[model samples]
Target: MLDLAYDLPAPKVIRGALHDWELVIGLEVHAQVSSKAKLFSGASTRFGAEPNSNVAFVDAGMPGMLPVINEGCVALAVKTGLGLKAQINLRSAFDRKNYFYPDLPQGYQISQLYHPIVGEGEVIVDMAPGVARRVRIERIHLEQDAGKSIHDMDPHMSFVDLNRTGVALMEIVSRPDIRGPEEAAAYVGKLRQILRYLGTCDGNMQNGNMRADVNVSVCRPGDYEKYQESQDFRHLGTRCEIKNMNSMRFIQQAIDVEARRQIAILEDGGSVVQETRLYDPDKGETRSMRSKEEAHDYRYFPDPDLLPLEIEQGFVDEIAASLPELPDEKKARFVTEFGLTEYDASVLTADVTNAAYFEEVARGRDGKLAANWVINELFGRLKKDDRAITDSPVSAGQLGKIVGLISSDAISGKIGKDLFEIVYTEGGDPEEIVEARGMKQVTDTSAIEAAVDEIIAANPAQVEKAKQNPKLAGWFVGQVMKATGGKANPKAVNEIVAAKLG
Candidate 1:
């Protein structure tokens, strides 16, 4: 059981003709397991292969093709369960989910229904600095994915591609704790971050490697609390499952539209129906696909071809020992160790590669300074170029050297930026470039004072006005820095200008 006292943002209220309604949302995320072969065959799991070239005998559901389980996929699922802080079931069974589709050669999906591999887990979704929502995981079951039915190739006849058939998937289902569109999206994003950090799934939605089935419903205010206490579905309104949303933006939009649709129906004296719906991105609305099916509708039964899966306690222990530092832990460490704000720590730890690069730059240096440079300077430049951190032209070492120069006051912040450009485009050591170009700051008191005196003499009227208004003294400082070609130390220039003016 999860603590219900955690702070969640206010529910998104939809105004109806009679009363306001709130959104209740849950998610079923299908994540493709990271593996080299199919779950029950030796076929390659590589993406973008020739239409059916990666299909094996069992994947095509041929006669006398007995299914053999792939151990790698099971191990990845166990790793994911451990990463989620979930209970890993040592003994689990596979069931046949009866379904018929053109792309489903076997006519049934091998899934875990009664006995799942993972049990209850919790995901702490950070809404703001100190606000979070705890979304509970109902279960994570292993299943085989169906293939694709391509209709765009030929209008008269559709085509079936079996490359994706039999690929392992972990259906991570969450309870109805999400309150709004934004919260729903954040829940999915947080889950994706964890899965990516665990190296269980790539979480690539564009390639169809990961997608979500969003269950959305609208209830009157105070009904959510009643449902929380009673643990009954009556308090929550009837839910409609939106199928296969691949994009985060689309997921949020779909939920909002669906909630409003439900609200409008109930306000118009129409009771909401339980069913499955599909979201049309361009249309920005959901249309009915089919009536929601109960468990018996699928005719689920245990598979006799494969025996129940049983693993030793030592197996779970070994996998637990090998778990990596997850995103939340890493973010907390970044905030504590680096003295960074929660926002900065979250941004830096969003991606594993980004966090690693930042650590390398911050090692043995001022962490706050290093974070500023890495987040603002490096990340801004990379975004402008449409480049990932792994593909960055500026290496961590070079960026660290630039930050070191700025910290040591060897170069002004302005000069540091200039040095950054030279090193980024021309590819040279930051220190060498600073030395070769003579771009060091003009920290010598005599040089700065002479420059300040010359500026004051050239502008006598401005100097008199500056004496009356000390704030206007910045005029002389700017002029001196401009006179020195922006290489003069700003602190030194300010001090000399203020003394001479006084």
Candidate 2:
């Protein structure tokens, strides 16, 4: 529902020797479906196993070996589509995309072309705090992945690893709504986050679990607006596809470099070539791979082995009902229910584990106090040790107990932090830790007042100066804290100090 086109000014279209241009982009993100088995085979879909160790006869394309559909894979694809709020097709069919590659042992890929599993979805990507952009999803189809071809180990021969072969992929196509590189990166990140939350894809680019092909085109400014208005794309100019971008940072960098490359060519009175390009991170540039392929190039046709996939509406409704509270909803609830700042809620909900941990620590306690301890003290310590929230030494229950003690005035803030260290390292109940360490607050008003009176008597000259300047009275409170070994309640010290000074 978020509009990306809002606040974006339409660029002026110019027809000149050196005319300014607009860059229009769309993305085809291939996310490996998170299932234990491959799409059409029983081969284990594990990463970094001994080469070909995870392959089956069907994955290796052994003669007469037939392909069988993996229902778990279908469920994942459907879940991902639901996460994007896309229309789920009750009936869809797979087809054979015939191609020839040394790594593609089947010589044909089983893919969905004619009827995809999902149709027409939209993604709302938050670019910054208040800015959101919507990118339209054209379709999401399932396809089997090809194997890996290793050419580096030998000069005269290439080796193929079919371990990755027949693995499931969801090709989520986006309309060319992106106008800049930063927005493109943001769109991919938001998609990854949603898929992860859905438990449909691991969304790990480093492990080759997800990748994107960015289609970029440059036109005279305002041509993009005209295309939006009239649905005429001829005015948008030739498009180049950047293939297999694996990193978010590299995606943005590739776009910037590719746009400038096209701009330089057009400025020199040369037209930009429409081709498939690859990005070289070392050189920070994109080079042409080949002319981009059309749908007919692959010779798509309905597969003979697999039938059309269909499910009842009740199944789809079940998935919708079981959906977890996602990131955006959790963030809003944290801000509204817990009284947290937008920034604080965002930080806590960015990761599911962190949000769950925060909820546990905040249970039945002061929300702001729990958030302060978790975000400031706990997260700071975890970062120093290079650990995640799940790896924290202090459990959520222990943290909640610590917050309770602070709220009940059983310990001062300083003593609470000391208790945290004890519980974090020594591993014991907070009350027991405070008792053993004598870290309980000096809540006895008589004891606190004695320390405050002693400090005031020792600094009569300072007390006289305090009467002249009320702000200077805080100096006496600090002195009382030092006199009591930091065990005096800060509020009690302040009250006693103020009374004596007056």
Candidate 3:
């Protein structure tokens, strides 16, 4: 986590009338483990269930009910830790995080603070092509999620949904390594990618499966570095937490809005308060929720019902062995083996499904052509249609065939695009479509030469201009393609046109 090999940028300080202020951010991301049962109870952890239908007696905090730790949840936490390259603590205990909320019938949330299962991990967040930042993970602790308290259900009263009660959560806490709003979002995105790859957490932020509590603080120009060297917390200024951020767009917006609010306070000769705040994206501002509490305030103590978790190194090794080729490794392989650009590889490998699709499409084909079609044509259409890669109408095999045809000069790129459109909407094989519609490229050099001669003879004026300026020769190729109804191989047409003009 504290590895200093990365080329992380310095804190981006903004100049003001009084002084330059640097933004310091840390995120506590709570991701729900993708298990069927709750953390301690046998209650189903299914989403959108009836208000309390998924609750077990233990989850409902019935009298005399005790918690039994779920081994699956613990295994997931370890798997996630390994995915992040973190230390897995074989022995960790659960503590009661006492707080009063209607949704939490138990009156105390089971969590780990002093002894966390995972520690000292780092996530590499890609800011741009060939640029990244390594945000340090302080610890990842397993905890029980409190249920939902819905305020808009009724006019006079709020409704409580205990279905989420006792659900398992991996609260991944990070150090204050993030410098900007975009970096914070990138960090979260990268972490979510890793978790999804591990199959531990689904990384679905919109469904309350994953949410971030962002801690933001402001400092002077050199204060960030000073705090790093001295290991002091106060140099970073008083922090305000924006809670339950679910969307990347809103996350960046909340940080910027909060930073400006803090700046205004400091510029007015006022001190910032340490409190929990909520970002209202609709209103474009943050409002106070409650004062931030220290660990002592929670009266955290080891839970009596749950025993200290103990595991063997062999368990960790097994999980590590089962790990998939993660996004970073896959991206590197795509760039090295497929000759893809850094940006294209990053975009393609950002999601598991997208990467798999691209891999299949690029297999034994011209990797560059496949990447271009996937990144530009297929991805563009999916974005326009509001669809995921999994929802794509054109399968990987179908798209790969399109690229193959283009590579083999069996069809021109124009015809290949037409073939893709037919497969996406109408659904058919690229080869069959080309054959059925007489769309196969005329790669025969003699046929292309005859078409070029006919076009050149008819359009003598354009040919004379093209010969004067060789760059204008593109017009001759276009004319030949148009004469052949875009069925002629573009390369062959270009060659024939160039030779005739010469």
What CA RMSD would you report for each candidate?
A: 2.1, 2.6, 2.2
Off-target runs (Cα >4 Å) in candidate 1 are 1-5
Off by over 4 Å in 3: 1-5, 459-472
Better of 1 and 3 by TM-score: 1
> Over the full model, what C-alpha lDDT does candidate 2 score relative to the true structure?
0.87
TM-score attained by model 3: 0.96
Better of 1 and 3 by lDDT: 1
Residues 1-502, candidate 2, lDDT per residue (tens digit)?
2122344633323244566677788999999999999999888998989998998999988999889999889888888888888999999999999989998998999999999999999888776665667789999999999999999999999898888999999999999888788889888988987888888898999988999999987887667778989988787788999999999999989988888788888889788878999999999899989998889999999998888999889988888888877777788888878898877887888777888999998988888899999999999999999998878889999999999999999898898888898888888888778888888888899998888778877888988899999999989888888888888899988888888888
Cα displacement (angstroms), candidate 2, residue 37, comes to: 0.7
Worst window of 10 by summed lDDT in candidate 3: 1-10
Candidate 1: residue 5 Cα off by (Å): 9.1
Per-residue alpha-carbon lDDT of candidate 3 for residues 1-502, written as tens digits (9 for 90 to 100): 1122466655767666788899999999999999999999999998888788999998888999999999999999999998999999989999999999999999999999899999889898877666678888999999999988999978999999999999999999999999999889888999999998888999998899999999998998888888989989999999999999999999999998998899989999999999999999889999999999999999999999988988999998998899999889888888889998878888888889899999999999999999999999999999999998888999999999999999998888888888888999999888888888998888889988988888888988988898789999999888888888998888778888889999
Q: List residue ranges in candidate 2 displaced over 4 A.
A: 1-19
* Per-model TM values vs. the true structure: 0.96, 0.94, 0.96
Expressed as tens digits, the lDDT of each residue in 396-476 for candidate 1 is 999999989998999999988888888889888999888888999888999989998888889999988999999999888
Q: List the residue pairs that clash in candidate 3.
A: none
Tell how far residue 17 is off in model 1, in angstroms.
1.4
Number of the top-ranking candidate, with TM-score as the measure = 1
